[model samples]
Target: MTRVVVHAGFHKTGTSTVQHALAQNRDALAPHLRIHLREDFDPLTASARSWSVTRSDKHFAAIGRNALRFFRSIGREDTRPVLMSSEDLCGHMPGRNGIAAYDAAPDILRVIADNARHWFGPALDLVIYFSTRAPDPWLRSTWWQNLRSTRLTKDLDPYADDLPRAADLSAVVDAVRAAVTAQVVTAPLEDSAARPEGPLAPLLDLTDVPADVRAALGIPPPVNAQPDLGMAEVLLALNRSGLDDEALSDAKRTIRRLAVKRSNLSPHA
Candidate 1:
């Protein structure tokens, strides 16, 4: 029986850093655990059959199929914990931003469960980890992250009070829990780094990652980690700079609207 750990992300949740660390330490980490860290977890990338999809629209469609294929590709003897990370999968459904109206939200949830069942098989023990912080901070981080990725805007004001209206985040957690044998791990970005032994331990323990391997990685016990602010800012600037005038202008408008709304409706305000 092969164990697969799916790190379905809610975005701006340190997924990239985790993926990066895994990729950097792939060779070292492999001796203890079988880790799949790649664009699509493709065993082969040199061939043209793996025609890369870089555009977001094409990439997402390709990703949906590729994700399932990646899961099914694993064989019985591969006992090492196989890990895959894709933050987009958390909210990549059809209709609403990350959700499509599947008759209703429950149906949408079932859709995710259905996909997981198909990819991982019935016997597979599924664990869903949602790295979360307080709504306010998380929204701030997300706003900045989007800025870096899309070069859309600089107004942090829009996201300053975003946590209160983040109903989708709560919905995602509920939907995932209802959809599969999942556990919701709530974390705060500020305390995540210091409390290295709690929820993070169970996640790592599932892989049977040895002490030596853990030590080699200098992984803390609680692993209460957060995103690097400087790196985040740089990335946001790069992403914002990449946007064309029209897209950038649109992003600015959205940001401004969000800022005003959050401010006016805020309990503190």
Candidate 2:
């Protein structure tokens, strides 16, 4: 039986970094694992201005097809694990006030799992995983990432002044636990920042991949970072500027570049 590992996300977690390493070091990992990044499995899912809850059945069906294809590619080896990752699996993409607020619907996993079983046999080994980060920084980064899509975040106010309710990590875990018969894994990401390899150690442990191989793949550079506090404040202010989407977006990019430059200059940075 082949194990299927799904890295469903709570965004701003080390997801991007983990995904980057998986892609860059695919050759190294192919023997034991084959990772399917979101874009690679395209017709898999879509997020739009209207999807307030979760994805359509069509999306789940696409994923089922991809899983079947991946399962066959491994031939009779069946020992190799098939890995799939898409933060959308968490159903919290445009979270809180963002465009299509995906309230943490645990049921989403059940639906995805049903689709997987249909394609991969009744006894599929699917493990659900999530990572966490400090709330302040996580929320701030999430806000910015969502902002990139003006259609979703147009009217959402800054969470700084009126802090949004804290995410209940325990609740999220419970949801995952209840939604699937598969194993559930969650880890805090504070230690990941200090490690160049991000959170590969824990991920390897989950897939039963060797820990030593982490050093061999080498660390990939970080991707999609959030702005510093000063920059975040500037961004929030800009959000209120009432500029049209075209101009607000242009200004946001300019501000981010400027802020990033200044951030890199300071000794503290």
Candidate 3:
């Protein structure tokens, strides 16, 4: 039976780094395992996100249809192990669209698993992997990310204190387990970051990518890292500023450029 792994994410947990490494080594890994990243599964992810907000049966049904379509496109005849990674597969990050937790995750995962079973046969080995981080750091990083892209005006301390149970990644994983029968696995970002392949290490292990191919695969430096607290404070101020949309965009671009240059020059960076 073919094995299918889905790295559905808990955001701000080094997900971007994993996706980047996969894209970089796609050619090398192709013979051993087929890889599908967020872009490859956009339609399914979009429907998942929409369903997360609306909680409508219509949107929920769309997720299952999209999953079926994706599997059909890939063809069930090919028996190679397949891996699909997308943070949005579970739903939006907690802070977005007034979402407090991955409340819809169990249902969302059930939809995907049911569709995969229907397409790949009931005997297919399906696994769901969630990359998680410690609560304090995850909340801070999530806040900084929102501050950068969304007009979130809250500072780190308040944001951290105000966060709901979503901060507890273990609970989220438990919820997923309760709702689906697929084998569930988790890799803590802290543990994965210490390995040679960085955040991609745990996944490579799970997929059993050939040892030689693993050695040959390029390990990408961290991508989408959160800025330091100092930089985050500046971003918070920008979000609170009275600038209009166009002006705010230009100002944020300038600030981000400066932050990136500073990060590049830092010895620790």
Among these predictions, the greatest lDDT belongs to 3
Candidate 1 lDDT tens digits, 1-269 = 55666665555555555565565567877876766655765422211122222224444344445545666676646667766555544443122232221113233223344555676676665556565556566656666545533444445564443334342466657765776654444444345445443334444666788877766674322111323424445444544576676776576555544554554422111
Runs in model 1 lying further than 4 Å from the true structure? 41-64, 92-116, 119-122, 151-154, 159-164, 167-171, 181-188, 195-202, 218-269
The C-alpha stretches of model 3 lying farther than 4 A from their native spots are: 265-269
lDDT of 3: 0.87
Would you list the rank order by TM-score, best first?
A: 3, 2, 1
Task: Give the per-residue lDDT digits (tens) of candidate 2, residues 1-269.
Answer: 76787787767787887877788888888877877887765444343212334346654455555445544444444567778777766554545444233344465666566656666675577788887777666666666765554433333354433334434555667866887777888887887656656765566767777766666876665666754546554666676677887888899767766766765532211
Candidate 1: RMSD to truth: 10.0
lDDT for each candidate structure: 0.49, 0.63, 0.87
RMSD of each: 10.0, 4.5, 2.3
Return the lDDT, model 1, position 241: 76
List the candidates ranked by lDDT, beginning with the highest: 3, 2, 1
Better of 2 and 3 by TM-score: 3
TM-scores of all models? 0.61, 0.77, 0.95
